[model samples]
Target: MTPTSEAELAELISAATTPFAIRGGGTRVLNADDGPILDTTGMSGISLYEPGALTVVAGSGTPVQEIANALKAENQRLAFEPPNLNDALGTSGESTIGGVAASNASGPRRIAVGACRDFMLGVRFVDGAGNIVKNGGRVMKNVTGYDLVKLMSSAHGTLGVLSEVSLKVLPNVEFQVSLRLADLSAQQAIDAMSSALGSPFEVSGAARDADGSVLLRFEGFEASVRYRAESLMKNLAAFGAIEQIEDQETCEALWSDIRDARAFAKGQGDLWRISVKPSDAPEFLEQVQPSKTLLDWGGGLIWAELPSGTDIRAKMTVAGHATLMRAGTDNFAKLGRFHPEPTPLAKISADLRARFDPKGLFNPGLMGDLS
Candidate 1:
């Protein structure tokens, strides 16, 4: 059932007789189960918009495109540049603000700015008990209790169903320029990206293509971008001949592809999103040889397409976790979709899950069987 209001949403969940497949846009975490569909699309709209203060508050189900358009009109945007994974996931899942938060979906820009949780100032949601809980105020500085706002981010809707959200927005960069270094070996690519990121040029995005090319981006005033592009080239002359993609259109398209990991979308086999230290990225790649790999977040984030049933965890030497981005539930269960937590951390996670979702009513096992 679609809920149009928070009150209605609480009532629906409180009355549900069976398990639910918690869904926001049906783009990510497609369904709760075959039991009942709690589509949040109906509960959408921008309730408060203060462009001057750089804050936009909207219902959880509000379309991300709608919010982007609104922010565009105001010369502001969600700094994280969250990706629309509909294409990447091969699902027509239109991204919603709430869904983006739940997935913690950040893009190439995450290397510089932060993740979705970084800009999230506040959240309002119905917990598993159907109680409406609000945390943090709409403004950027509101803080009076436990940081549930961040706790909910990336929780995959296991904790609760978000109702409303408030976020800080930043003015869109006036100009962005991309520097490309072609045909660098994986280690060379990582080194080149690392150099550009560590320099004082203020890089906004960095990634390596499946073909082993490295891309570094700088965004800011036109002159600043140009200056950095030149400075960055001089800094990395030993890596290779650096080329420039100065046109905003091309630069944006390239970053978008990298952000969504779109190149691996239509490929065969399972897709895994691995997070590791940027410096350790190259070494990690040596252990896990995938059919195709794309590096983003300045080599800190790796997206690999390995054949289904591949032993993913066994291929890692660095301290990092591999998440099965696209896979069957049974295989995920066998392979452990998320990184296995250590004993102490596992205990804390189990306590949190049990306390918040005691009845196991919300998207059962969505966050995995922590207990």
Candidate 2:
């Protein structure tokens, strides 16, 4: 059904009466579990742009690159830099703004700034009951009730079909500098990263590549960045030889790949995103012994691509949080923290599911069965 308006979208949803997966440019759909699909690409355009207020409202299906480019023209940017999943997944499609919110795709900047949910101000969507519901608002400080806009960040179209979104934007920084440390052991690198985080220096991004080389980024006013980079280099000298990457084009290209986990994409396997304590990284790596691994979020997020057909879930259980990023089958990774618990909050989530989609008409197994 081609929905020209929210009302039409609601009508279409109500009439379907079957489990349907929402599609935006269909970028990551192939990796998604199978179900009836509802394409939202037809519902695309920007509705409002308040540069002074640092907010923009756009159709749910609007391309992410389009929004990024538009924001760049005004010297503003999405605080939560959404990852380029297309490049990481080795596929081509326009990743929609809605998809980024739905997936809660975040990059290195997430460590300092925020996640997609934090910047989300409001959303207009068609709920499972065939009703067009609006939550939050265009203004940043309008917190009058439950923040449903934030709740929908990583919902992946399971709760409702997004129609429009309003988000907070930040002023673009003038300069960026990357400090590279070579030949440090994984544990040593993570130690240095943690030390930098505690310092007065403002480090925006920190990660260890497959070669065990650590990269740190500082972004802000040119003078501040320069001062911070020099201080950080002096403090982290014990780790290894340090080199400053000052080339603008090269810096952008390098961070762009790091943001999306491009290096681990080539070797095909069951990809797992393991979130462990920064201090537990060395022990976690010893357990998995993955063929390739990239540590990000200062060792909190460990990107590991295991050998094909490996049972990564068992290794992931050692860590606190784990998600099977790419899998050949439906079960994905057996998560430790995300599993259903016998608690009041679990009951509330169950009730909300029943209210929204009694028949489970949206992405039934994506977040595990409601029942």
Which consecutive 10 residues in model 1 have the weakest lDDT in total?
Answer: 28-37
User: TM-score of each candidate?
Assistant: 0.96, 0.93
Per-residue lDDT tens digits for candidate 2, residues 214-294, read 889999999999999999999988887899998878888877878888886655776777778988988888888998888
**What are the per-residue Cα lDDT tens digits for candidate 1 across 209-326?**
9878899999989999999899889999999788899988999899888887888777778888899998898788888888899999888899988888887888888998888877
What is the Cα root-mean-square deviation between model 2 and the actual structure?
Answer: 2.3
RMSD in Å for candidate 1, one decimal? 1.6
**Candidate 2 weakest lDDT stretch, 10 residues:** 332-341
Model 2: what TM-score? 0.93
Q: Which regions of candidate 2 are displaced past 4 Å?
A: 29-33, 317-319, 330-348
- Steric collisions counted per model: 3, 0
Highest lDDT, which number? 1
Top candidate on TM-score is 1
